[model samples]
Structures are given as C-alpha cells and as structure tokens.
Target: MIAVNGRDTEWREGLTIRIIMQENKYTSPRIVIKVNGHVVRQEQWESYAVQDGDDVLVLHLIAGG
Candidate 1:
C-alpha cells in the first residue's frame, strides 16, 4: 500500500515518480514531490521507485508577486 496526501492507496507495482505524476495528470516539473520524507529531484523521477507503505506527498508550486 502507498499513502498519497495522507490517504492510503493500493500499491501499483513498477510505479515510478514519473508514472505517478502522469497518472495524476500533473505534467509540470515545478511541482514538488516528496517520497518517504525525501524530496525527489526532477531528473530522478524516472528512476525514483515508490514501494509499498511509502508516503508520497505532492505539493503544488505557489508564486507571488
């Protein structure tokens, strides 16, 4: 199982950060992603693998003038 934004979800095997972003319809690299309390780099998304019981946090980027 994987926890996303405080909700538990079934583990999706072979799910990479990239795939997760795609599944969630997020294409912007500006979004922040944290897996198991660690920030995942943009280039590492394709290689960062998510496992069962992992906590994934997806945060949107906020900008201000």
Candidate 2:
C-alpha cells in the first residue's frame, strides 16, 4: 500500500515519483513532493522508487500578491 495525499492506495510495482506525477496529470515541478517525511529531489524523481506502505505527499505551491 502507498499513501498519497493522505489516502492509502494499493502499491503498484515499478512506480517512480515522475510516473506518479504523470499519472496524476501533474506537469510542473514547481510543486514539492515528500516521501515518508523526506523531500525528494527533482533530479531523483525518475530514480526515486516507491514501494508498498510508502507515504507520499504532493504539495502544490501558489504565489499571490
């Protein structure tokens, strides 16, 4: 199982942060992603593998006046 946005989901094999973002229709890297309380570096997104029971957090940034 994987926790995404506070929701637990079934774990899918061969999953990566980039793939997750793509699957979720997130096209920008401006947002931050934290896995298991640790921030995942942008460069490592493709290499950062996600497994069962992993907690993934996707935080979107907004700029306002």
- Using TM-score, give the best candidate's number: 2
Per-candidate TM-score against the hidden true structure: 0.86, 0.88
Residue pair clashes in candidate 2: 1-53
lDDT of 1 by residue, 1-65 (tens): 89888987778788898888887798876788999889988889898889989999999887886
State the displacement of the C-alpha of residue 52, model 1, in Å, after optimal TM-score superposition. 0.4
Winning candidate number (lDDT):
2
Predicted candidate 2 versus true structure: per-residue lDDT over 1-65, tens digit per residue: 89889887777889999988988898875899999999998899999999888999999988886
* lDDT for each candidate structure: 0.86, 0.89
Please give the range of 10 consecutive residues that has the lowest summed lDDT in model 1.
21-30
How many pairs of residues collide in model 1? 0
Off by over 4 Å in 2: none
